[model samples]
Target: MKTYQTGNIRNVVLLGSSKSGKTTLAEAMMFEGKVIDRRGTIEAKNTVSDNTEVEQIYQRSIYSTPLYTEFMDNKLNIIDTPGQDDFVGGVIAGFKVADAGIMIVNATQGVEVGTEIFARYAEQHKMPLVVGVNQLDSEKAAWDTTVDSLKQAFGNKVVPVQFPVAVGPGFDGFVDVLKQKFYRFKDENGTREDLEIPAEYADQAEEYRLALMEAAAQNDEELMEKYFETNDLTFPEMIKGLNLGILAGSVMPVFCLSAKKDIGVKRLMEFVINATPSPAKDVEVTVDGTEVPCDSSKETALFFYRTSVEQHLGEVSYFKVMSGKLTEGMDLVNPVTGAKERVTQIYAVAGKKKEKVSEMMAGDLGCTVKLKTVKTNQTLAVPSVDWEFKSIDFPQSKFRTAIKAKDEKDEEKLGEALNKYSAEDPTIEVLYAKELKQTIISGQGEHHINILKWHLNNVYKLEVELFAPRISYRETITKVATASYRHKKQSGGAGQFGEVHLLIEPFVEGAPQNNRFKIDGKEMVLNIKGKEEYTMDWGGKLEYYNCIVGGAIDARFMPAILKGIMEKMEEGPLTGSYARDIRVYVYDGKMHPVDSNEISFKLASRNAFKEAFRNAGPKIMEPIFNVEILVPSDCMGDVMSDLQNRRAMIEGMSSVKGFEVLKARVPLAELYKYSTTLSSLTSGRATFTMEYAEYSQVPADVQDKLLKAYQEEEGDE
Candidate 1:
């Protein structure tokens, strides 16, 4: 392969909802570029993007496949991403490296939840988008409906650059409004004949062309003046205006295509090469807010956005040359870690097929294998330049499950496997919850984790079971209580004796301190001396006051007493969970001068604290999360009902962009497998995000159930 300069390289990402034909469109684009002799369909399982066995089994894309095609003197680097919401990590990674994107919308479905989501992401990233209305040859294709939906979602920014002359098996070609020419397809192989606009379609073509011109003209002052003066734009003038509008995200030019039949694929590629923003037009940012221009003259720097472990290939690192040129066997230093790495080999990747390339220019995307320590989101640059591009921020996990190996011996192997999977997809999180004593794995949804499980079963051959993860509940007191304990041990040579008296009370922020307490109808006063406040590692605070009057207990044993109290706090009295937000006062105690060692005080204090905690009004508190859900209007009631059933407290609800936005605070315990339920309730047309809020006390019934369950487990033990 010949080397391409930054100016002639175009990096584009393919995005859309499932069944939107992203993979098919990619195959068609490859076919048009002569990169492949014949097109492959999803059914045939021969497409370049979905080349993995998992993808072939599921008939969908699971990973973002970086592919390149040489067409029209341009090296078009395409990143084909998965359409499912569970696999949105790929889309985000795509956004980080690509200068522009093609959002494929299925003509039959109009718009879907995934479409709305990807569109929002593109808008947030300020990416220029070219809309491709695919599957026009399908039986249920409806161009008007799809266009209306697009307008509703995107307002006037959605403008059609081309419209199909006929759809539904009669779809041969579309009339280009920008070119003012009709393209007739000679066959399904993308053979085309250019002709004048037919009389039957001229009026419709003119209408869309006028809309396109207005949309384009509004983006630039000069174009607006020209449109006002002449009420039209020349072909070159229109292209210029549209390019500017696209860069500014003010216009999305829509085109029609039947990817399965290869209709309009060549034209779409040509338009992309001409209109979309090239790599030279993009400016990347560093971690420290420095802008790096995509120029080959500067020092060499490479940003690895993704890394995968392929069959027979130890590790494949995909990166974009942020600046300067990269040649094979070039040694660079990782700016973040200062580790030396040698780019021994680089390849232009087309799924599983790799073409060896001797050199790659700045702004070109390629892959290199067998790096010593380079990983995703890391940067490598020459010693003189210190550049680390900003990392991709993936979405939080919406689903969680505790995973354990079926065989105890495979536990270590399971940990290694999970770590490798999380490295490949950062969205998957794995952690060992000490309180729950379970290893929890979290991801976008159940399907996302299930795919990981499939990989484990097939590739790693590790059998694992996934179950509901235990919630990290906290125990706290709601009222004050008091207790006393005595510890005495008589031995042959020596004796141990210690007595402790303490008062426990619920701690509230900004509450006044109290010294007077009435116990057993007797009023008593305590002088708080040397109070110590500690912030619990779990959450909340613990304040301890030494109210020992007249030196009833020496100060030397205070540390031991506090240690005992901490042990209890670590494991609460009610459900063996962590305890928080309470004040402890050691008002009085007795100790044998000879036997009152640290061990004696520790035991006495431990018992006294436990007794007081049990007498106090203890309650269980569970973790709460702020959940935001976006669902279609028709599915609002059902989704709301499901949330209510999960003990969710609805915070707010409103309409946004033809979808209902529902906000609620729900306990993590009740939210297990919620993504699956939401998908089932809304037929996979709903999406949501969850974030940790604050811990709140559970209901009385729930508290009782948890306490009883804990007691039962203790009894069994």
Candidate 2:
């Protein structure tokens, strides 16, 4: 591969809603650039971007892939991204490293929820935005309708540089409105010939051209005055203003193309090469805390945006050399961890394969192989670099499951494999329950977790069982109680002797001044809720208190009492859940100095806690989550009813795109496996997101059942 050095290396990311043909469009560009001899197809398991087994079998992009192309005179590093909502993390990561973006929208569907998601993201980052209306060759592909939708969704700034000349069965190709030229595609074989714009739609094309011109002219006062005076601008002049608008981050250029039919793609290629701003000309920020310009004149602060798992290629990382040159065998500091590692090997990656390279220029994107500690979203801080770019924002994962390896002996290997898998995908969470001894895995949805399972089986050669996660509830006390105990042992020269004298008081607000606890033997005390009174308050009341003046209990032994109380809190006052906020006062107690250390007091405190907790009232608390559900209006009644049954409270509601966005708080226990239920209720059109809200007191009957179940399960274990 030849290094195309023209100060014109443009790295652009391909992003859009799911099923928008982003990967296919990337393949078309590669094919047109002659970077590859043949185009790879998604379903055929041969696409250049969908290379991973998870992606190949799923027939979708699981991660972003970097494809390089030489168009016109500059090198284009096109980062193709997964369009599925669950894998949206990859799409966001792709944007962090690209100077500009090619957001694709299906011609028939126009703008969608996912498209809006990325558009807002691009706008937030001030990235140069470009739109590609793809699949013009397919049936129901209405060019006019898509253009209208774009206008409505994105506003007037989304000016089309070109429009499709036909739609659906009549689809042929696109005509360059400004240049007044049309490209006729030979067929799916991708051969094209230039032609004059049809005379019939000339008048309709004029309307959009004026719209484009007015949009472009607004970017420059001189151009605006010229357009107002003459009511016209030449094609080359319009292109110039549009480029300025793009560089100014005030306008996004929309173009037409068919990825599968290879129509109008060649025009897009020319526009990108000629108009897109080079990396050195775009915005720049520091990786550490120093200011660094986007100039090759200084040492570089290269940042890695993504990584991939390939059977042949070991840990290929897609990175941007922010300010300086990056070459094989050069060392750089990862600003995040302050770790240093050599580049070792530099390569240009296309999905799964790699082409070895010697160096990549500053402000350009390339990949390096076998870096030891680099991870996604990590920035390498070189000297003279000051500020770090904004962190990538990812969506909350909704899918979840608890998983454990099938073979006990494979536990270590399973853990190692899961760590690697989770590193590549930040959307997945791995958890272990110490009590249950189960390793649980969670992801965005059923499909998302299913893909992780597939990787574990195929890549790591590990078998596993996946189950729904069980709710983790905590226990505490609600009342205050006091207990005293004595420990004596006489079998040696120094007999072990200790006594615990403590009043367990319910926690209170004023307890801060009175919260001091004593330890004569084994005991712990906290002025917390539910320990204020001998009666079970299920909250703090501060029922127990004492001022042991004149050292009725030796102050030296106070530490021993605290140790025992700590154990009591951990083991729990009620059914061994856990306890807190109970104040223990050791007014009087005896301890043998030989056996009255922290360890002996810890044992005594455990006994004291059990006795005090039995007298005090203990209770359980369950987690609640704030859930935002967006579903079609027709399903709102069903959703509300279901939420009511789950003891949820509706907080707010709004309407969007024939759907209702409902904000509610529901217990986490009621929300497990909610994705499947929401799919069924909304007929697979509704989506939801949730976050940890708060811990709420469980209802009386529910609490009883949960407690009973916990006791029975503990006994069985």
Candidate 3:
């Protein structure tokens, strides 16, 4: 590898649907660039991009693999990303750093669901796109239909720069519309010879060439005028116009290729090297709130977009030089952790292999070995520079399961492995739900979680189990009731003697109407003194009235009584669920001067609260989530029916981006595997997102079941 300036660097990401031949196309590009002697096939599980064990077993990419190839005096850094929607995090990570995207569309499948998702992501990132109609030599390939679908889905901006002359068993050549010449591949080695346009396809070639001219002219006013006057534009002029159009996202040049046969790949590489913008050209990066340009002369700053753990190498960090230059052994500050780290080595990443590089120029993507403080989405810069690049925005996790180590002894190891994995992939999250007493692992979908599990078992050698998480139900009381308890234990020496009288009721804002605290329109107030209201930390209120005006119970013991009441509130009397939104009034009590200590008052108070709660009508409340499902209109009826079966309350329905959006509130219990179920129902065409909404009382039958289950578990314990 040789040092190159930012202008000589090209960062592009490969994106498409599963089995769209993105990996094969990448292999073809590498082979043409002479970086690899022979191409590796997906069926053999020897492709450079999908090198992981899980990917090999699944026969799909699970991570974004970065590789570089030099062609036409430029270093092309290609980030090959996974195409599955479940592994979209990899695609988004690649898009975050790449200057442009090459969206590969399967000729046989046309524009499928995954293709639409990648297009939307590219549009969201404002990335310039180059559409590659791949697998052109397949028997089922329909080039014309696929081209039409591309135009319809992506608009008039999509214009073919190359059209296949013949697309089946005899497919060996394509017409270059821009050059108005025929390129015939000599063999499977991608050797091509230029030839004159065939007599039979000359008319069709001319028509497509005219369309390309018009598409290119739409970018610049001067080009449009020149094309209108002469009815044609020179090759150089067309290239210039198309470059501007691509940079402005006003043109999407479509290329045809049969990656398996290595045909037309050389031409695609030529176009990319000639027309694609360099990383330093018009690329705007921001540090903190200040916009920074990609200038090598500026202060050193690097933004890490991906992180992974290699077999021998502990932590390999992939980054892009956002500004200035990154040299080996240079000390940089990790602004995220405010720690200074020395860059010990710099390497140009080629799949799992790395080549030592002296330095990485501005806008170039490379990797650093074992930075202690550096992690994904962290900014490394000079200590004097008080700036950090914006972090990548990953999608929220849509599916979750309660996970635990198969062997109790491996709990700590499982925790460590999960933390490292989650750090590498931001889309996966591990959380401990204290109320539910479960360690929950969440990801995009079932496939995404399965990969993590595979890594845990195979890579880390830790067996784990995943199951549905327990619902975090809450307990609350209704109505008003009074209970009294006395703790008098005079065994031998100093005795424990205390008595407590408490009036329990639901808390309500504003003054009591008709001399009653209404709990669901039921009068539940009791007469009390010193009615001082206190708010509990866990969503409830405690109204204490020390009607012991004559000091029936010492004032010093009141705090102990409140502490005992709080303990019970944390683990409620009914079902042991956290109690909320209730008021307890201590109107009267008795105490012995010699034996009434804090312990005695605490015990008496705890027993009194349990008795009062049992009489007050306790109810269980379950957590609700605000769920939004986006699906095609055709699947809306089935989705609605599924939601109804899950006891979901439909709030509203609307249309967004050609999809029907359904909004509803559903209980967390019913949504355990909703992501997988929705994917099955819609054939992976629909997606959904959810967030915590509020807690509401469970239905009477559900409440009964929960209480019974809790009691049975307690008995077993």
Candidate 4:
């Protein structure tokens, strides 16, 4: 482990669809830098980037793991992100730290679903993007297909900076058109050699060179003038022009590499070192409407939207130092909690291996000492600015799992562990509903939350059972009724006496929905604005009032009645669900000189509300959510059909991720167990994310069954 200066830094995020060899590509990149003597294989689960236990077991990256390679006089910070939709949060985390993005495409698979997605994400963030056609050593590998696919999906902006010297099994090297040199790797396990460009590839190289020169020529008017005058530009000027186009996002240089064999990696490393944008080259960012220039000289805030508890590391937070230099033991104010704490230690991260650093400069990434109060999406900055960064907006969690401790005694620990994990990930959510008395875990998909459950048990020793989440259902009344009750008690010398009369009716029965309070067809609306009121309150005193309508229902008793109605609301009317938005009018009532106090009125009103609710048409309402899925185009039919079977309303769909991004709204009840079913249908290729959309009346048949079950559960309790 070693520390490097900012000039050699090239932070890159490894992004692609599943099985695209992102992990393998990262291994080769590190190997080329001589960080690792041998390139580790992904199948072997011994790579430097995918070192997490979960990643090792699953044979895939579970989260973004940071690594660095000191290559050719530069430090390449490689962020390996999970390609599965379940772990997109990891991808986004990587996106935040990187100065640019590298999109890997399976040579034969071409630019599939994931390539389209992460590419869009990169563009959305205005991150500079480059494409790499990997696995050229494979016999069936097709560079042209992938290149064309990228062009079709990414438009005319994608241009190749390098050309493969050969294709398929014959592929052994690449020729840099801009540099006019040929380089080859020795074997599937890598070693680089410089050689003459083959005669056949020389022509292709020249053709691609023209494409490169054309793009570069447009980058500067002087270069264009130079090109027109002589039809020849110096190699130095060509490379400079090409880099300018790249920095402008006008071209994404396509490189060829077989990460599995480590071929073509050396040249890729060289290109990144010489061409990719450094932290200084990155564009400026703004947080809370304040600009944070890419300057490592000043103290600034680097807000972390993701925080996790790495084993043996206490609490580790990954953040991009947005503005200023960050030194070990420097005090950082947590804008989230308003807590100021000193950074005890800083380490440049390489997967699980950490190289301690004395300080972290702007655009530098590393983890620091334990800070429990600072949770995800919290901002850490100098005391002067006192700002919070914008929150990361990701797809919502679609699947849900209701979980309970295997042993009742472990409930508190289970809650703590789950909360920490949630704070560490934007995709995972653990929700506890007091009314339902259940703990439901929601995530992007089943694998998302299931991985969390596994980690909970394996890492924290918390065992829990996963159950289907419960639907959010509500109860409301429909009819009107008047009820009266008296609370009376007598013991020894003192007595408690309370009486009240309350009327219950549909919350919005016959009323015009407006500010003027005009009566519609069926409901009587109240008009109290600019009205005179008789001075009255508890016989003589009044608390406060801006408008009183001819002393409507004795303003004093109105408060008492409101108190009782509030209590009844909690108690519920039809099925004991909390009631909402209802109006009650009291026209006739008698007050006892001594016994008819506000307390008495409150009690009577509570009882009356309950009695009136019995007459209202009470029904149960269930919550629903709008869901969106981005899956491979081939899986679209199966996904849409599955959604329809799950009682979903397919609103529409469009192209995304080289596939279809489907949109729909579904009842929460039907979505509870959709995680397991969707996995079965999509072969784990589809990812669903949803959020609270709306609530509507429950169907008759389903409502009847639910009410019956609720009644039985209540009886058992």
For model 3, the superposed segments whose C-alpha errors exceed 4 Å read: 247-250, 282-287, 508-548
**lDDT for 708 (candidate 1):** 92
Candidate 1 lDDT over residue span 1-717, tens digit each: 899999999999998998899999888888887888898889989998899899999999999999988889999999999999899898899898998999999999998777887998898788889999999999999999999999898888899999997789799988998888899988889898999999999899889889999988898899999999999998888889999999989899999999998888888888898888778866788989889999998899999989999989979999999999999999999988999999999999888888899999998999999998988899999999888898898888889999999999999999999999999988899999888899999999999999999999999999999999888999999878899999999977788888999999999998898899877688878899989999999989999999999999999999999999999999888888999999999999998978888888998999999999998888899999999998889999999988889999999999987789999999999899999999999988888899999999999999889999999999999
- By TM-score rank, best first, the candidates go 1, 3, 2, 4
The local lDDT score (0 to 100) that residue 621 gets in candidate 4 is: 69
Sort the candidates on lDDT, descending order. Answer: 1, 3, 2, 4
| Candidate 1 structure, TM-score to reference | 0.97
Q: Candidate 4 has what TM-score?
A: 0.84
Better of 1 and 2 by TM-score: 1
State each model's CA lDDT, in order.
0.91, 0.74, 0.87, 0.73
Listed in order, each prediction's TM-score against the native is 0.97, 0.86, 0.94, 0.84
Q: Kindly report which residue stretches of model 4 are placed more than 4 angstroms away from their true locations once superposed.
A: 1-5, 165-170, 187-189, 215-234, 283-286, 300-306, 335-338, 370-376, 379-388, 477-503, 508-561, 589-604, 628-664, 673-689
Q: How accurate is candidate 3 locally (lDDT)?
A: 0.87
Question: How far off is residue 615 in model 2, in Å?
Answer: 3.6
How many angstroms is residue 75 displaced in model 2 relative to the true structure, after the best TM-score fit? 1.4
lDDT: which candidate is best? 1
Give candidate 2's TM-score.
0.86
Better of 1 and 3 by TM-score: 1
The local lDDT score (0 to 100) that residue 153 gets in candidate 1 is 84
For 4-88, candidate 2 gives per-residue lDDT tens digits of 4527788888888878999999888888878887888876878888877667777778777888876777788898887766666
